[model samples]
Target: MTKLSLKSKVDFIFIIIIGIFAILVYSTRNQSQLARDSRMIVHHTSSINTVLEKILSSTIDLETGSRGYTITGNENYLEVYNQGHKNLEIWLDSLRAMNELNRGQVLKLDTLERLIESKKQISALTIKTRKESGMDAAAAITKAGRGKEIMDSIRKSVAAYQNQSVKLLSANLNQSEVHVKSRNWNFTLFAICTFAILFFAYLQIRKNTERLILEKIIQTNLMTELTVQNQQLNDFANITIHDLRSPAGNITSLVATMEQDSTLEEYKVIFSMLRKVAQNLNESLNQLIEVLHLKKNKIIQQELLVFQDCYSRTIESLQGEILKSNALIKADFSQINSIMYSKIYLESIFQNLISNALKYRDPNRRPEITIHTEITKQTILLHVSDNGLGIDMSKNGSKLFGMKQIFHNHPEAKGIGLFIVKTQIENMKGRISVQS
Candidate 1:
């Protein structure tokens, strides 16, 4: 994966981490708020119970005052009755306000109100009868027990209100317990998930480190093996140059000697063929030695050499071929005048390109080769193009620069030229491309 994509994925994970934190914070807040609401419900329910008790107490006080006034005909007792009646109204009003949301409690409070009003009226009537119609009338009303009946009704209604309030308080307490349990569970789950994520991250990091270390070890061993193989290759190349080229040189000498005395007309073609084969074999060996020499010499010998000068030398080497083909050559190195390169390799590269272009020229058309250069901050680019019998790249793309991989139907197409050029360029830490 790319660094940017990995970074993005890491950022996404952090976002998820942050999101989890937010959810925890939000849930914690909700849990706390729920707890507070539960406490408030308890407090309000108690307040309501207190108010109902006060109402009942005030009603009893009213009843006691009425009884005293009726029995002893005391004006001071009527003042107590008046005080209790005022307190009863105030407490009932508070209870009604507190229980407004509870429809059943409101109805019970309404009934309590009516019962209190009726008891008050009956006590007042009994007291007024004691004042106006004397003890006989008041005592008769008491004997009938009408005021006691009204007081009993008031007490029953108050009890009903108290029972309902108790039920609500009990329900609120149960809900508070449920909220407490839920919040605990939520915290527990959050802890578990966080631990799991951290554990997984640790495992992945350790695994990746181990894998990377293993890969580095393998790469080190491969590089060491490659170095040994490359040294052996150079040694074999040196051996071939000494042992094989000496015999080729001897063959060339024999051919030259035989040619000097040749008189048989029919055997002339055979001698010429043998001479050509000896030269071709010697040339291939020399090219191989050059390639292996480059591979063995790991140290770069660089110089600031003019590209135009190199191309001129290459043309000079191919002077005979150019004349034979009547080829036209063009050079434009103005864009990039010079390069830091090895003189021998650079010259060989140009010579091979020019020679191949000429060698592969179409019989129906005159050969034209163009050489140019471009300069960038990083690289010096050289381009060589030709109007010749071009190879079909699509058909032989993979093998284009492979050894002994010929493409064209040319008598002298060895196919090792492009491979050598590619090796030389790459040895210099440069890359090459083919368009056709």
Candidate 2:
């Protein structure tokens, strides 16, 4: 059995209690109604029995009077006969009234009415015989037993009708009891199913809530770890840049002093080589500093910038290096007139691309490079290409824009230039693509 959560368990218990209470209430109400019905049935049956008894008593009285007149041959016995006849009429009316209340008793009433009429006819004949002849003749007529035989037949019919009424009453009572029992069972089963559904729903809600809480906790921990790692990387970059600055400065100063003393030719060549190495190192240091600045924060507070003016300034900065390499330079700015960007960032991008073209020139070929812009509905497209030592697409394609990944064996290649370019583009919510 899987363990249920606190809320789920509470809901389960609550639902079960509610179900039990509902069943008790419903069963009590149903049983009360069933009892009321049973009482009504019993009341009707008792009334029918009372009517039946009255009719039977009247029949017995008529029979007795008929026999009495035959035996006594008196007018007083006729009085008894008349009284029984009147009572029979009254009982029949009462039977009819009772049957209106309980229609099942109608058959018994009909049989009783027929029997009473036959008895009345037989009593009238007895009276006639007593008045015409003597008591002996009436007695002989009674003893002949035709009236008794008719009475016997009437009694049998009444008994059959009573038996049928009794059977019908018993069947109705049994059916009513069974129906009440079946309703009780169905109500109990429905309550159980409803409680089960509520309990399961509560369990699912609690499980999902718990899972969400755990996921949030894990995400918080991961974010905290990443923040600490970023801080450590920033600290290391600062320390390394501070340590390298002094040595690079001392080397540049010593090479400058040696180049100024030009008495020895071989020493001058050695000093020039040392000066070039120092210049390269200084460039590498400057690149590192720029990258660190970008990593700290690329967004700068700046005034509106004109792209044409910025491009002209960047080209002027690289004019000497471009002239030395004899590189062909083409510029196009007709489509995009200007954009809002930091002038330093734009200058850095232009200087890096132009310097790389000059530094990575194909030894056997003339250098050529192109820079241009195209505007669309949503964005401005910038293209920078070179026919110098173009990138070897197969060997360095994937890592071309990665940080600190050098492609050609150029002395001035620091590999951070294109990486910075890509980062700057993305920081402005722009995109960059390279092709060879």
Candidate 3:
């Protein structure tokens, strides 16, 4: 039956679209990871090359400074020699920190290090000989050609390390290119499939437009009937509450008089129980009357209310409770300061929300409440948030605004505040939602 329906066909197409979207997302993520790895390889290779070049430059500087000082016997040449040594040590340490090198690459690096150390020792020996021994001694050591051989060896080792790094980089880049080409082809195919499905779905949606128009007419008629029925239900509730009010009041009066006249302790206890029951019944009837009045009125008064004024009035009314709980209240009405709404309902909303925040605050921390206003294209939104014993949404979320539904085990929780707030907002064609 579902297969035969046009809407079902459209839904199936949409489901396919979602599947394709998921595949595309996965492909994109994989491509991103591969690209990231390639970048890391390139960066690592660049760092190694930079360190190698620095080591070669420092080796040359050490050789130059030693030779220059041996010939001229100048003290300034020692500064360059000392600086070259410091730079070489730093650059080598940096290269060694790069542990991603393979065994072959690490071996090449070790050979380079050995040659650099030999060159450094030779340069230091020449400098010390020139300083302590005569110029002849230092010149004799330089002329022996061992320092030249060590420098040549260092250069060759550097070239080998550089060649190995370039080879590895080229291999990695080639592999990445292959993967990229495959992924690009697959993505192109998926894109073509997505376009074809969307085009087909668009045609199917055009065909369903007339059916939607007819359904809208039927829905309008059904809404009319629902409105009439709702009015009738409201009337019935009004009559029921009116009939029950007198009986509830009578029960309360009788219980009170009986309790006062009772002599026996057991009878007094029984009368007290009856009194409590009667009082609860009376309170329930009163709350019901208030709700029925809202339904009957249909159109309550609306006025332009300034948010700051309303907020201040509510705060003033609850000044005692706020001080007692050490609540820090904040308000921001900068977006839209005024709105056309019922004054009583707006004030009641502020009062109930703030009272709950202060009442159910976390005892370990001082209470902090934030009230703010936001404006969308067509609606003004009021938000109230607090640091308190939050509702257990998993257990009590559905029944949060239901009549007489209490979540926290507080003595003063009548459970009617949220119910009344929700009713008021909905009565004015507004809405309310909560997050824990």
Candidate 4:
């Protein structure tokens, strides 16, 4: 398991907790708003009820006062009548103001207002007749069917207003309950979603940790394989160089001994062939030895190497062959001064490239080689180019620097020169590429 730092773990947990708290706060606020709406609805309903009750009581008081006046002709009945009329007027005004605040109550309040007006008109007519005519006449007017009909109509209107108020209150209550329930469920779902997201983030962190470990293990295994391969290559080169050195030494000694005598023509020819073979073998062995040395170490045995000096030295090594092939060699090292490099490796790379150019020259054209160097901020680039027989792109382009790979079917081609060149450059923490 990969252990997270305390701060990071705390931050992750803090974010999850904060997220859940935010959701809960939002849900609580919504529920609070719904509760406020429900309370307001209840208050409005109570207010409407109070107004209706006042109106009903005022109508009842007017009927009683009119009856009292018809029977006794007392001034107290008129006073009671006036008080009830004032109360009714106040209640109707209050109801109208409430209806303005609550649009849904407007129609019911209008109907109630009309009923109160009709009741007021009938009570006024009764009062007027009672004051002018005698008690019997006023009593007769009070018992008339018109006044009773108006009272009945007022009762019917109040009943309708009361029924409508009850229905509206029930609807508001039901809607408020539904809103509360939905808020509760939404809070629960939000918490569940936050937990799932946190869990998924945890799983992803664990997976990434495991992936990093696996990649590290893979890189270690690759490094081990490369080490083993390098060791095997070095051992092979060492053995080959050791075996060839003995015969090369013997042939050089034999050639000196034969030159001491006036040799016969056949003997001279044999000695010359042996000397040429020995020289080629020595050159091949030296190349193998240089490759082996480079594989065993990283930093080269650096020595001051002047570009012009190294160029001349390489030219001298290939002088006889260059002359035989009539090859043209050009050099431009103006941008470079004396630099440090391993002498043997540098000589080998230069010798192989120049000699290859000569060996692979086109039969119909003269061999031309150009050697130059360019210096950049981070590295130096050395380019060795030739206008000889260009490489065959279709056949051997990809395997140009592969071990024991040859592009041309030349008798002297050993196929290891470019491979050694690439290895040496890599060992020195540089890179090499060829384009032909």
Candidate 5:
């Protein structure tokens, strides 16, 4: 469950839903086709019945018109005969067309068509006999009963066709009833299955949400505890640095006083060394205090500071060292001369890097430290390159920014400068790197 991501789970649920919906669509389409077929059957049956009745009615009209003309020799009876003949042809054609699908009905319709034709021929013969011979002659043809036989046959055929159509209609209605029931059942089953899947998905989502909320609460509590512990550690570190500063100052003062009182030439060298050690200790302590102060204020106010101003201050502070080492320092801030940063951090960074370069200068050549700024699409870059007794990266790269990690054998190699610089940069959400 933990291995499955939220997107994967959601996709799986949707796949199931889509599969079910596709099945429902296919099933409903088949049911709809069944319903459509039932309706077509019902319509065909009704049309066949109507055409059979009309054929019977038209035959009756022909028989009545021929009989009337045989008795009275009326021309109106001939008109009825002509109209009935036209109606019979039309009704027969319609039946033939409609019954094409049913072979049995086609056979019945063929027999009915022959019977109607025969009935029309007899009526035509009687009418011709009445007009050409006389009423007596027409009566003689009708008296033989051939026309009545054909009429009875046609009636029987029509009744049989209508009965078959009624049966077909009944069967289709029953089948349609079954299809409707099946469709209802399918819909109910589909509804139940869809609900089940949706309910299961809902439960899974609720469970995942609850678990996430619990994890978030646990994480928040841990963070709160960590913040409190970090604050306490900072307080302890500040107190320790404050206490240590006074002793380091006393040592510096004592060394300075002892140096002034020295009388012998040999003692002068000892005093000078002693004074250097005390001064170095005081500086280290001061640097440590500065680092502690940086920790105390995690978020410091930033102001726009000119790169040239910070560089000048760092150079002025290290004037003595620069002159002693015969260092060549140059800077180019043409691309970006100013930045938004903590003044203390920027000045300390310059002071540390420049001083280290001077301190670790190659004795064979004059120290050359080049500082420049560059602007890229995303960020402003500051480069500080130096020609010094370079570090062996493979040996001391990992420990370069570690406190008290000395790589050089110089007397002033406290190893805290790089560490402090790294800390300051990181606090400002910036990073520093070195290459040799």
Candidate 6:
């Protein structure tokens, strides 16, 4: 498992907190919406009940007024009967307006309205019969009216509707209660989770503070050790340049004077070989001096130069040697540019590799030096290859870059060129290797 950093853990907790907050908001909104729907259901049911009561009251008024008119022949009673009929129609119209409640409720409503209409028609017929004819005709009309059956039906329908409305109201109340309970539980969970998140965040902050202090102490100790090592390295470089390089310079001067003496003719080949050996030794010593000086990982006035431009400078410095050897120098830096590198060291590196190619050129073939660079996963690599007298890996591979170890019998085969290249590469924390 990958371990999470402090920041990652904090972010994860923050995300969790946001998610919980969102869920709580959604839950609360859902609960509120449910409450609204429940209220609407109750209100609709109550409105239906009120309309039914009005219809019942109006029917009672019509019954009393019609009976009073038949017995006492009162004009005021007829007016009451007319007004009750009008009120009945109004109440039924109100019920019809809310007819979209439920399919069963609408069907029940139709039956109740039909019963009320039947009662109104009978009452109107009975009153007309008593006014036109006599008590006997009105009695006959009453028998046909069937008022009791119609009233019973109206009552039964009203009761059924009331019962259904009550059931619906009860169901809505239960649903609202459940929503409220769920919302409360969710809010409780949110509060508990929020508290836990804060507690863990506090602990994580404290742990991070302690870790930062420890890291600072470690960094300070490391800095002190690095300072001591740097001083020791500087002392070592001065000793190598002063104490070791002076003897090599003196040896080179002695060999040059000995080479000029005319009396050494009988042993001229020996002297020449001795001079070559001393020069190689002196050159190798000078390379050691340079390596010591450059061993420190310090770039003095470092510059960012184009790789192609650096190669051009090196080629210009060795123009005579390149032409005399009939050498072809090729370079490619097309894919990348402005690579930050030490200009002086880059020029030196390029010069040594190119000059060695010319000096060690094969007798039968002209020298073709190819210098290129490419980026790898870990670092940028600089490659210098030549189609000249290449080193015989099977013979001189072990000493290819060793001090004073020569690969070819060429005059400049002091083995210091690649050593200098390797040292400069090391100072920059880079690796150098050869495939052949």
Model 2 lowest lDDT segment of ten: 238-247
lDDT of 2: 0.61
Could you tell me the TM-score of candidate 2? Answer: 0.38
* Candidate 4, run of 10 with poorest lDDT: 254-263
**Leading candidate by lDDT:** 5
| Preferred candidate (TM-score higher): 2 or 5 | 5
Model 4, residue pairs in steric clash: none
lDDT of 2 by residue, 39-115 (tens): 46644654454455455545655765666566555556566567767877886787687577656567656766776
Q: Sort by lDDT, best first.
A: 5, 3, 1, 4, 6, 2
lDDT of 4 by residue, 64-142 (tens): 5665566567778777678779989898888888778667678767877777787788888878887887766766776
User: Scored by CA lDDT, what does every candidate get?
Assistant: 0.68, 0.61, 0.69, 0.66, 0.71, 0.65
Query: Candidate 6 deviates by what RMSD?
Result: 49.2
State how far residue 91 of model 5 sits from its true place (Å): 2.1
Residue 152 displacement in candidate 5 (angstroms): 1.4
For residues 1-436, write the lDDT of model 5, one tens digit per residue. Answer: 3687878888998899899889988998999898889867766775676566567657766875787687777788788688889989898888888878889989998898899889989999999999999988988888887987897788788778877877886687677767766766666666667667766877877644454345446645655655564444433333333223332333333333432224444333433343343333334445444544455475466889999988875665454466556789999999999999977678767877887798789999989999999989868789999999999999999999886688889975666778767877887899999999
Model 6 agreement with the true structure over 207-313: per-residue lDDT tens digits? 34454345446645655665565444433333332222222333333333432123424234333333343333333344444443454444344668899876765
By lDDT, the better pick of 1 and 6 is 1
**Tens-digit lDDT track of model 3 for 124-193:** 8998899899788998898898987897788778778877876766666665665555565556566567
**Candidate 6: clashing pairs of residues:** none
- RMSD list, candidates in order: 51.8, 55.6, 33.8, 52.2, 50.8, 49.2
Cα RMSD, model 5: 50.8
Would you estimate the TM-scores of all the predictions?
0.44, 0.38, 0.45, 0.43, 0.44, 0.44
**lDDT agreement of model 5 with the native:** 0.71
lDDT of 3 at 113: 81
Candidate 3 minimal-lDDT segment of 10 residues: 240-249
